[model samples]
Each structure stands twice: as structure tokens, then as C-alpha cells.
Target: MKPAAFDYHRPDSVEEAVSLLAELGEDAKILAGGQSLVPMLSLRLAFFDHLIDISRLDELKGIERRGDALWIGAGTTDATVGADRQVSAAVPLLTRVTPFVGHFQIRNRGTFGGSIAHADPAAEYPTVALTLDAVMEAVSPRGRREIAAADFFTGLWETALEPDEVLTGVRFPLSNSRSGFGVHEFARRHGDFAIAGSVVAVRLEEDRVSHCAIGLMGLGSTPRRAAAAEAAVLGMPLGELDPKQIGELAMSGLDDVPADLQGSASYRARVGAVMTARAWTDAVAEAGGEATHA
Candidate 1:
């Protein structure tokens, strides 16, 4: 199927792009790498009267570092960041999960901002952002605003971003030697959307857990932090771990999960618990934290 005819405008700068979006309002869809939007357009799932192409806006491309966090431009390709020295050293989780996203060709064109804006619960960035407590910067004709990743995604394919607002970039804090990050997901095939997944970020000090974040995807209406699991693991030494207790805490954290054609709520909950446990194991291994249950 072909998309309906639309007017296209290529903006050279972020200001110009914001102006176009403001003028066109809801009728305009900002084109990033088109990895996600193009398909929707082709299937007529998304209809727009105008396309404000920011793909060429040079201001929105590339990576930068500010203090403790790495600022990734909205237009940066997933493939590029996956191989970047700054990104690899600063936040290896992005590099670790980039290969799991779509394919090489799609990653070459897929923009980080596009993934965040799409707000697909099954996608990697949203989970990563939430797990890392990243910040999203959005610019509009009115002004610029920064939103926490937790507050960015409101629901399925929905976000706190206004129609006229475009995400400029995302800022994720750097991982240090004391930090451990792990991403795990199960899919029928490589690059396919995850059936269930978990991302874990932990800060360990002298073999004791200081801080922990557990983000789950593909089993709920939206990405959510596993607060109960985090609380259970916090201050606990990884060496004296109880897998059953950990699994129960993780399961208890997910009070409400959505049922889908892929699986029932029970099935998803089971997968989620397994993934969460595996993620914890991997994260502890990476952190050099002692293994207790072996």
C-alpha cells in the first residue's frame, strides 16, 4: 500500500524545523530516519498532510559529552552510536543493545530520537532510557523543555511531547567501573520485537549493591521500573543471593500486565521473571560482584 500524497519540507536547522512544525501543527509529521514512521505511512496506519523532514538538519546529528552524561543528538544513527568510542566508554548499554535493534541497514538510518518518539514498549531505547534515568530534551516554537525519561512515555505510542514539539536529544549518564549494566530480551528471531525483556543497572560499592534499577518491557502497557525488585536487591550482596526471593520480588513488582495475542498475562509474567533473573546474573557478573547462589 502507498501513502497518501503529502507536502514535504526539508529543514536545514532545528529552528527552521520547529517553525515548520509550528506552522503545520498536527498535520505535519517530522521525519527522522523513517525506520519506524515510513512503514506506518506505507501501510496507511499514519496519515499526514505534510512531512517536515528534519533528517537533513545538521544541528540534530552526532554525539557530545557534557560533564557526567553523554548527549546523543536526536538524529544520531543507532549504528554510529553503537560503534562510537564515547558512547562505548560512557554508556556500553547502548552499544550492547544496538545490534539487537532491527538490522544493520535499519540501524544505519534509524535515529535514536525516532525510537524514543515512537514510544514502542517493545523497543530498546525506551527501556534503556527508563533504566538509566535519562533525560529527554524537546524544543518547540514556544521554548525548550527537558523531561525525565520516566515521564516521557505516557502510554502506547503516546508521549508527553506536544504535537509541535520535537525531541532534540537524549542525555544518559555515563557508566563507571562500579556500575553494571545488562540487557536481555527473548524474541523468536534476531532483530524481531522482544516477547519479554529486562534491563538492569546496578551500582556496587565494595561488593555491596548501592543502587539498582530494573526496567521491564514487552509485557506491560508501558515500560515500567521494577521498584519492588530494586528494593529487594538494594544493599544486598550479590554473593548471598536467593534466586527464588529475587524472582518473587520481581514478579510482585508487576502488579498489572497487559494481555496480548502473543501471550497471556501469566505467560508474560513468567517470561519477565526469568528474564529479570538472568539480567541480574549478567549484571552481577559484569560488576565483578561475588556470586552467592552458585
Candidate 2:
């Protein structure tokens, strides 16, 4: 199947893109990398009257560090991000997860901002954003605003972005020396969407957990922070932590786990727990201590 016939507009600047969206209203769709949108269009799962291509917008293309955060342009490709030295040094969780997004070909054309805007529940970027408290910046005809990662994702394929807004970029906080990150997921193949996944970032203060953030994907309508699990490990001695108990607590509060042909809700929940445990354990080791539990 092919997409419905639609008008295509290539905008050289973000302002131009926003203007097009404002004028076209709900009929306009922004095209970044088109990794996700192109497939959807090919299947006729989505249709738009016009496609506002912003792939060439110079305003949305760069990677820089500001203060304590790394600002990644919305137009930056996943392949570039995964291989960037700055990304690896600043936010290792992103570095660890990006390779799992898709095969090399897909990553070459997939935009970082595009993934966040699409808000696929199983996408690695969204889960990383949620775990690291990344901030998304958007511009519109009205004005510009920053949306916290926690508040950006509303549901499956839904986000806080308005119809007339363009996502400019995202800002991820740099991890300090005391922090360690880990990401783990289960997929049918190397590049397949995760059936269940977990990302953990831990900051240790003298062998005790000082701060922790856990994000779970493929188990809910949107990638969600595992607040319950984070709270369970905070301030606890790393050696005293039980991976099994922590994993269970991490997902215990989730009641909306999605079920599908890939697996049942209960099965996802179980796998999610195991992944959370592995992620937490790996994170703890990376933070400087050997994990005592399996």
C-alpha cells in the first residue's frame, strides 16, 4: 500500500516549518528523518494533506553542550548520536541504548527528535529521555516552550506537541562521576522492538544509593518512570539490595501493562521485572561496586 496523495513542502528553516503547520493546521505533518512516518505512510496507517519537510532546516541541526546539559538537535541522526564522543561521555545510557533502536540502515536515517515526537512506547530514546529527565524544546507561531520528559509523553503515539509546533531539540543532563547507567531489553532479533525493556541511572554516595531513576518501556501506553522501584533502592547500601525484590517493586504499581500477540500482560510484567533487575544490577556495578545479587 502507498500513502494517500499529499502536497509536500520543504522548509529551509524552522520558522518556515512552523508557519506552514500553522497555516495548514491539522492537515500538516512535520517530516524529520521519516523513519517511522514513511513506513506508516506506506501502510496507509496515517494520512496527511501536506508534509512539511524540515530535514534541511539548519536551525535544527547540531550537537552542543550548554552549562550542564547536552543539547541534541531534533534533526540529528541516531547513528551520529550513538557514535558521538560527547554523548558517550555525558549520557552513557543513551550510548548504550541507541544501538538497540534498529539496524544500521534505520539508525542512519532516524532522527532523535523524530523518535521522541512519535512517542512510540517501545522506542529506546523515549525510555532514555524519561530516565534522564531530558527536556524537549518546541517552537510555534505563538511562542516557544520547554516540556519536561515526564510531561511530554501523553500516550501511545501522542505527545504534548501542538499541531502548529515543531520540536526544536532535546536537552539531556550530563551524568556526574558518581553516576552510572545501564539499559537492557528483550527482543526477538537484534534490531527488533523490545518486548520489554528497562533503563537505570544510579548515583552513589559512599557505597549508598543517593539518587536513582528507572524507566520501563513496552509495558504501558507510554514509557514510564519506575518511581516505586527507585524509591525502594534510594539510600540503601548497594550490598544490601536484592535485585529480585527491587525488580518486583519497580513494576508492582503498574496496572496498565499492554498485552498483545507478542506476549500477555502477565508475561510482559514478568519479563519487565527481570529486565529491571538486570539493569539495576548493571548500573550498580557501573557506579563502582560489585552487585552482590543476581
Tell me each candidate's TM-score. 0.96, 0.99
Candidate 1's TM-score: 0.96
How many clashes (backbone N, Cα, C below 3 Å) per candidate? Answer: 1, 0
> Residues 8-35, candidate 2, lDDT per residue (tens digit)?
9998788888999999999999999999
Task: Estimate candidate 1's alpha-carbon lDDT, on a 0 to 1 scale.
Answer: 0.86
What is candidate 1's lDDT per residue for 99-193, written digit by digit as tens?
Answer: 88999999999999999899998898888998899999999988999999989999998999998899999999989778877788888789998
**Candidate 1, residue 253: lDDT:** 51
Against the true structure, whose lDDT is highest? Answer: 2
Instruction: For model 1, state the Cα shift of residue 222 in Å.
Output: 1.7
Q: Which stretches of candidate 2 lie over 4 Å from their true place?
A: none
Backbone clashes (count) for model 2: 0
